[model samples]
Target: MIEIKNLKKVYAGVTVVNVPHLEIKSGESIGLVGNNGAGKTTLFRMILDLIRPESGEVLSNGKNVSGAEEWKNYTASYLDEGFLIDYLTPEEYLYFIGGLHGRNKPQVDEYLASLTEFFNGEILKKGKYIRDLSKGNQCKVGVGACLLQRPQLLMLDEPFANIDPSTQFRLKNILKTENKNLGVTTIVSSHDLNHVTDVCERILLMEKGVIIKDIATSSSTLSELEEYFGVGQTTSTNTGIDNEENH
Candidate 1:
């Protein structure tokens, strides 16, 4: 559903993102993993058209994302709390997003009801603006907004970073259900290795703004990744591992 070609982004003479070619098929659950300054979020921003690439293009359903508004109709992304309307309460923020998606009040309420377990009783009826909530609660609000859209393509950055363990597991199940049952194309970047591995069937390891590894997760995928990160590593060792068996 998404294709990237010759994508590159430079900052102050440093090349932060340089993806030559990448394609993500519909209903694919993808996990992007990398250390800090790896440019994972930069790549995501470009895909969402929040940042224009210095070269190349991002295509959604065969249309360049930068040139078309159609992709926004089916795409939902939440990278940070900046995506939220901080002045609005959680319910208000969600309702606004639902309205944009053509969902009425009743439909949004029903959907919010379904997220009781995921919210763990901290999100709704809090009586506080989104900016007043704690970091984890703010993240919950952002994720709730994304899910409310029932998007065809969902992208989240570091979604597992702020929430508690129980909420993390809940989110993993939600993502899996969205991909396997609803056929939503899910792309999530996370610092937690276990969370990403459990939810995604494919994993991309990035370094120095390059996709050095494209691994199809297997029974031993977690261990393989752990091993890769365990030892002090550098991009020079495995510059670009395109296939799964290399792991």
Candidate 2:
């Protein structure tokens, strides 16, 4: 449901993102994996029109995202604390988000109830504002608000970071359910190879402003990714590069 053509973003003469062309079909789950300074977050910001691209356009359903509002109706993204209204309590923040989607108090309460297991009793009925919560708790509030929208396309950055291990497992299962059961298009950018591979059907490996590999996840995907990252190597002088030719 999304397409990119010659999408390139530059900063101070350095190309941070330079994908020539890419397409994501409806209901596809995509995992984006890369190292630090690999342009992953920059690309996400451009696609969401949070930043202007120096060249090319990102299209959602054939319409340029930067010039169109239709895509926002079905797209939800959470990249960082910048996406949260930290001054509001978790309940208030969630309620505000639900109301934006035309949900009433009762409807929102029901939705919150569904997230009980996901929240693990740490998110609701708290006396603190979202800003007072731990980083991981704030993240939960953000994701909860996004899910309350019942979006068709969802994007998250480093969703596995800063959360407890139990919460990570819960997040992975939630993503899988959203993708497979509800047919939502989910895109996750993370450094955690195993978690991303378990949740996404396809993986995109980006480095130095370029998408170097687009892989369809299979039984060996985790091992292959670890190898590419030099984690599987015995020598410390690894290049963190796969010798296989890029497709």
Candidate 3:
């Protein structure tokens, strides 16, 4: 389980994330939705201990994440290209990450085989470094590396962004399957209400750094989110980093 109590982050005295209390149980797939600057990325960074919180704490399965390394064993995240080793080829990068998780070359190879469709013939053996891949392809590598760890807790920020429409659908199915079969506790932040509602069992609405709504996935959930975001009247492409360009 993941726990948060009075968690907060500030930049120049302006609070970006402030959650009084929040709990995420095991095996739950959660989706976070909000406009740019709503604190989605900030909250994920704090949970991953990539950024130090100004107050309170984040607990992963009863282990405090801040200033600790124990939680990293069971947690994996892909927030941006910064997570990737830009100098290495896709194959090399995956093997390196797998080794850290105690997986050998053969094990990593088998796992990469399973993701062939996700790679869509562009990743493995491409003879290209991570920095050379297109933005969408780089997103694929980062996300694939995270899954290779088979973590207990997986966090992704705007994972669907930059990918083509077909791959987006594949990714949605893959994430849902991983969470269901592997019992991975997944947290994804996206602006696409349709995709988020389709994959997440729970949806969290954030505005100005506070969770304004939390509801189970249902026929009405998407509309509710659209209404809240005032997006029902307009078309929602849920397009790339544009969704959070300011963030």
> Residue by residue across 93-114, what tens digits does model 2's lDDT show?
9999999999999999999998
TM-score of 1: 0.94
Model 3, range 1-247, lDDT digits (tens) per residue?
8999999887767777889999999999999988777788888888988888899999988888876787898888998898999999999999999999899999999999999999999898979999999989999999999999988989999999889998999999899998999999999999788999999999998877889888999999987887867854343333232333343
TM-score of each: 0.94, 0.93, 0.93
The TM-score obtained by model 2 is 0.93
Scanning candidate 2 in windows of ten residues, the lowest lDDT window is: 238-247
Residue clash pairs of candidate 3: none
lDDT of 1 by residue, 30-127 (tens): 99998777788889989999889899999999999999999999999988888999999999999999999999999999999999999999989979
lDDT of 1: 0.89
RMSD of 2: 5.1
Candidate 1 deviation (Cα RMSD): 5.2
Worst window of 10 by summed lDDT in candidate 1: 238-247
Question: Model 2 scores what on Cα lDDT?
Answer: 0.88
